[model samples]
Target: MGTTQLETVPEPKYWHLRTVLSNALDSEFEVGEILPNERELAARFGVARATLRQALEQLELEGRLQRRRGVGTTVAPPRVGVEVNPTRHSWPGAPGDAWQTEGCAEDVPPAVVGRALGRGDEKVYTVHRVRTVHGQPVATELLYVPPASVPGLSGIAGLETDAGVARGRAVLRELQRLELGGQERTVELGSARAEDAKRLDRLPGAPVLVLTTRYLAAGGTAAVAVSTYRADTCRLTFGESAGTGLLAAG
Candidate 1:
């Protein structure tokens, strides 16, 4: 590979190094290829290890690289395009949904969810799900359903066994029985919580995209879903029939 020595520039040295490294990534690296260690990278670029670390962190945040726990930093795959607008809207767990049911339990939802459901301080059936692409987990979802929304669901005693998974499916089935209404959704940038970070194989406080959806039925909010997606590996797209192509981050 060719080396480009840094010249005096107005920008910070680390910032200039980040741009050089990014150009190298585009010209020389393939997806899933491990990058050189910090020492080698710093030496190659004629920069200190601290400067290299800053550049690597910036690249990782920009979705051009991934730093795994046991694995070294590698070129990340193109960001998965997640459609935020569909031509047809359906309930969660509907046919062809990418998320897999993990478990379910009765718990008090957060105050925001309670406000959306108009049920304050009441226990609701919370279903946990993980969304994967090409066998890699990319997002985690928590769906909260008030008892009044799924009155027919029963026999869910625990959330740590096979029965728990079955109960989760049952809750989804019961949810489908409701008359189709409408839904509202909002997306925001956030830091991954500890539990979500564990599920996504990221450090605590990693950047994430939080999507909140409120499903309406029977003249009230029937369910609320909060999905946390890895900002580095997923890009939310808006439009029906939008292709799954990663857009360049500005």
Candidate 2:
């Protein structure tokens, strides 16, 4: 009788498939390229349809793929970045600003925003925008301000969209009058939440740069702005080489 031996076969892993596909995309695919339809790709890889989809979803979350409801998934374009610090070299909202205006939204912000407003949550103005650089969407900005802090807001016409650098200046021009106080800013490691991830076109857990700034004016806090920037694509710059630097660290 011939000796019989049983050989155990390892189960296939879908994550391995995703890695293979991701590498292929980075090495060979062009931005906006439509990937092979799921059915075709799954058959080619000898993987189940569900397994193939799992891989695709991860790619889409990483902003590597753009999936449409009906148009199919395409390769994602690059992301944009906007500098959030007030450096001597670059003001907050200056002409030739790296970020282009996306739009503004007025809403009651989160509880933290309410605390920043000091009204316990009554006053709020949220300016929503997508900051881009070199034609990529790298960050999303939500600027919140209490109405009392922005006393002359109505007079500061059109700053939200077409105001340009001068608009930021005009909005902040009053700072010089209200005792021109100091400010506190914090930078921290963070991940993009679902909403921010959607706007920034990255995964929910993607690394991000979170800059929280509290502006002080007229013996009180004027505004608090939280800017979420993509870590993979941006390097936040602060201070200038030549000018007199006037930033207070807190």
Candidate 3:
């Protein structure tokens, strides 16, 4: 590849470099290919290391690159397509569901979740789950089910023990008994919280897509789930055939 010095343009230097790098990624690099070191990249572009760093950071945020600890920087795989259409509704943990239950605990949820449940300050069963694609953790969820929703769940046991997994499974099983009237969902961009960041292997305050779902049954909200997905690895889709060719544009 030939070197191209950056021209003096009104746009920010880093922004211009980002475009140039993006084009090169399209024409030259394959997915998961390791990038040249910062010094080499800077010299090749005839820009300072600071400018090159800024450009690289921008690309990572846009999902064009990944900066893995100890592995160096490489082109990122295409974002996974996650279906978010409200019309396609099913209770979590259904046979075809992709999430794996991690644990369950009874706790007073955040104010936003409490409001969604319409049970202010009341304790609910919070089921923790992780969603992975190709063995890579991409999302984590906090599913809040009111005690009233899962009346059959018994045996108040330790939540951190092996029993916790059983408890989470029981809650999900009980939920399937109810008649699912419908569900409402909302998607928004948010910063990763400390807990969610750790699970997704991202730094706290990294960009994430927050998907909040309210499962309605018996004329009330049966459960509320707040799922945080790594924005760099996911693309929210709203169709029956979601996630197909999500990265085709790249």
Q: What is the number of backbone collisions in each predicted candidate, taken in the order shown?
A: 0, 5, 0
RMSD (Å) of each candidate, 1 decimal = 3.1, 9.2, 3.2
Ranked by lDDT from best down, the candidates are 3, 1, 2
Residues 72-174 of candidate 3: C-alpha lDDT, one tens digit per residue: 9988777877678744678999877889999888899999899989999998999999988646688999999998998876554543344377889888998
Per-prediction TM-score, please?
0.84, 0.57, 0.82
Residue-pair clash count for candidate 3: 0
lDDT of 2 at 100: 48
Question: lDDT for model 1, on a 0 to 1 scale?
Answer: 0.84
Across 136-198, the per-residue lDDT of candidate 1 in tens digits comes to 678999999998888877544553344367888988999999997988888899999999999
Off by over 4 Å in 3: 8-13, 27-30, 155-163, 240-250
Q: Rank the candidates by TM-score, best first.
A: 1, 3, 2
Best by lDDT: 3
lDDT of each: 0.84, 0.63, 0.85
The TM-score obtained by model 1 is 0.84
lDDT of 2 by residue, 75-172 (tens): 76653323344553322354454444454545677888778768685746565556764345667777676667667766665665543445444544
